[model samples]
Target: MSISTSAAPDTGRGPAEHDVRTQIIEAATAHFSHYGYDKTTVSDLAKAIGFSKAYIYKFFSSKQAIGEVICANCLGQIERDVLDALEGVQAPPERLRLLFTVIVASSLRLFFQDRRLYEIAVAAATDDWPSVQAYKHRIHQLVEEIIQAGRAAGVFESGTPLGNTSRAVYQVLVPYLNPVTLPHVSALHAEAPEALYQLVLRSLAPPA
Candidate 1:
């Protein structure tokens, strides 16, 4: 019987494959954070992980694929944090405020610390990838829940379908939440986040 030394590229196919893939993602995240996505190469990653360049290819198809994995992990973390903050909050407006504050602060931090993840996120958004679309859709639903809650509590405007109003809010906040525009937003420092948050809240509320 001949012994095979080569292992095929697989994702979640087996413990061996999953472990290798996880190792690759963890190592790739560090390299990308330090050198950025554009500058980091598969060979560099393989060298860091003590694997051959071909072995890195066994788990990830390209640098972009690896970046996507990183972005997913990072965004999932933010999502979990956001959901945790929303728990046990009875006031809709208060919940919305907390949501935006955490989102802006976390996004800014993510941009500074792991810009490679943000860069790949922007690219994914630009390309309109399905996974990204689903991600955004899920986020949109969460925000929509808040909007609906606010409407029920009489803190937000009524008569419009919740989806329409929530989507409009999402569009306005896209500058802050969308990775493609994050760099541009970071360049400006004219207004405080509280000011921006209040402005967004005002847009949703009816005149006194």
Candidate 2:
């Protein structure tokens, strides 16, 4: 992806600051992913795009802050995919199906585009990035709400544990849809996402 840049402001202050900040983030992600997180430096990030380290610092206080922003942006993209799928669908099953399909497709596509970045971010995630973690929880809550809806409609079996099922679905996905691991599992090549979805649905669906 091209690193989008912002024009310098006449007043030397405005949303351009925010746009420049985003540019720094985009550049940092590309650099950090290409070179492992440990190897990437502020000078490298700044020089990679012909900007100065001082200039980058004006926006990001530190490398960790930049990493947090990039990590949060990745989660935000996933949230957008979920919200887009949730829009316009009223039926619980169809809505749930769409949510599953969109997340799988979008995640797979994104991971394929930059597996190293995701890998690095995943490693960093265990350290507890609250913003990213919160976004992830929001997405999980959205899925849980859909499960609850399905239960209310009687389309899915009643009395199913929505929280546990939602967590299970999350587990099945993070590995299955991930590009780094998908190649090792042969079944994942054929109908991985659908199979996983069916498993979750079976657990949560009302009695036959």
Candidate 3:
């Protein structure tokens, strides 16, 4: 007598596994959009995805963990837009200009197109989300690259350390980039981006 055996569950990132994960993320995005992150729960996510809560647990540890992934995905898209915009810019100043413009435009578009995406971004800024810092660091890295390019080209002065300078640049734009403040800013002035961008450029200028 032989015992019947079944294949183990697909746990890897094979096509089938990837498809299921994508489905979950999509459903989670919709739920978070309609209900807001604070109101969304693991059970709601699983139900919306047509999977058991235990099934979601098998992949993600908690509801917050899933939200963090969604935030990271949005940041990844923003990074791609920044890189794409920078490609045609020949000068560092121009690269910096495009970087700020593209990001602001992209953020506004994302917020207006689906305010839920912006809400998740706001959580990243206001709450101490674990994965949020990584995305912020990635953004700062892009800014530093442009600064370094400018220094090499003799277009700008770099008296301070590049790392410190980059941090200052990103921090100063908190109002414009921080999802928490971004909407308010936009609400007051729809065309405030160019004005804010001027301030960004001034920050990078060498002291006289």
- The models' CA-based lDDT, in order, is 0.70, 0.66, 0.70
RMSD of 2: 5.3
Displacement of residue 159 (Cα, Å) in model 3 is 2.4
TM-score of each: 0.78, 0.74, 0.81
Query: Best-fitting candidate, measured by TM-score?
Result: 3
Encode model 2's per-residue lDDT on 1-208: one tens digit a residue: 3332232112122244477776776777778888867688889998887898888777766676677666655656766787887888899888777777777676666656776677655654556565546765676777778877887788876564667777776676656433345446534534766776777777776777
For candidate 3, write residues 112-151 as lDDT tens digits. Answer: 6777666777777788475567767678888888889888
- Each candidate's clash count: 0, 3, 0
* Runs of candidate 3 exceeding 4 Å displacement: 1-17, 188-191, 199-203, 206-208
Screening candidate 2 with a backbone cut-off below 3 angstroms (N, C-alpha, C), the clashing residue pairs are 156-206, 157-205, 157-206
Candidate 3 positional error at 51, Å: 1.8
Cα deviation of 104, candidate 3, in Å: 0.9
Count backbone clashes in candidate 3. 0
**Candidate 1, 90-196: lDDT as tens digits:** 88888878777777676677656755556667776788655566567777887899898888888988877887888887775667777777778865533545676
